[model samples]
Target: MHKRSFILTCLSVVVIAAMLSGCAGTMVTPTQQNFKAPVVTLDSMEVAHAFGYWYFSKKVKPTKGKPDNVGAPLDLAFIFNIENPNEYAVKMENLKFTVAFEEFDLNTVASTDTMWIPAGKTNQVRVHAHFDVRQSLLSLLVTGGFQLKAKGTNAWAQLEKWWTGIPEYAVPVHVKAGAAVFKADGLTQVTTFKATFP
Candidate 1:
């Protein structure tokens, strides 16, 4: 009787072990074969910080001074949601995008920050871009001078509108030609996106 009881216990253990092994064999792993493309979307954009427009000039051009410039610094933050549908964690290597105010392209910004998005989960990335009034005016003149004239508006008018309205969420800001690089298990994917903000 004792021998029979020991044999039954051993058999039960063997059966459980076999079942666990089979389940393990069928379980999915995060590998190149099972990787899925991740999705990126602009969640939100806001004026992080801004100093209203200002200009300064020295009437007496004292030979030792910087050029007369009218400019203010504006900081904008963009938040993006990255969704990973694969069974493995993916790393975002970099992200780049061009910023447009109204219909004019203002500047191109890039973030080299690395982030890991978990499998079957969503992660948020916040990128900040700084724009100077003087620099932005230069860019506008170079890129959109003709367009601005066609619209019957000059750089100052547009810049003033953007500077004041952006803080109040009153202007339309656009994210264009966006590209993000993601990697998982030796596989890489580049995703492109574009969005507009109110």
Candidate 2:
């Protein structure tokens, strides 16, 4: 009888330990996931002339002065209008992107958002980009289209973790656009515009 009771108690303890381990495996934490911006339309405005002849005379035949190297850095801005078109609010983070110019890899850019838009709501986001004109003009003159690529964090996984009560890092963004040459001379040039997110 004593031997039998001892064996029964050991078995019970083993069963209880197994059950606790199973419960711990099921435990999860809740944390919000990253938001990904949909591929929206990218529209470009008219390409305005960056330089114009200022002073010149037809008097005694005079040789043209040095090329108007005023604007050396070109500024290009593109606006994207995004529509929420979804049911859930997207948390913006963990996004990565790259830009290609004239078939050459240039650089990667980062993005920032000032506000968040609720579901079925429309908002505006802005992206500002600048590049060296001397390096870009050759490409622009050859190819009219500038390549752009972007990527964002996975929202669903983040949502699942959040719902499960797990802590997660904030999402990040990646942006990139082809560069263009400037007509004038300048060290730094900037392009600023706004994108409407619906």
Query: What's the CA RMSD for each of the models?
Result: 5.7, 21.0
Tell me the whole-model lDDT of each prediction, alpha carbons only: 0.87, 0.37
Model 2, 1-198: lDDT tens per residue? Answer: 999999999999999999999987774322222222333444532112222112222343446555442323423344544444334443333122344432343335556543344555654444544544434434443443333122232322222322222111122212344221111111222233222211
lDDT, candidate 2, residue 10? 100
Q: Best-fitting candidate, measured by TM-score?
A: 1
Question: What is the TM-score of each predicted model, taking all chains together?
Answer: 0.80, 0.34
Q: Write the per-residue lDDT of candidate 1 for residues 99-198, one digit (tens) a residue.
A: 9988888878899999999878999999998998888888988888889889999988888898888889999899999999998766888889899987
Native-referenced Cα lDDT, model 1: 0.87
Error of 2 at 70 (Å): 9.2
Least accurate stretch of 10 residues (summed lDDT) in model 1? 54-63
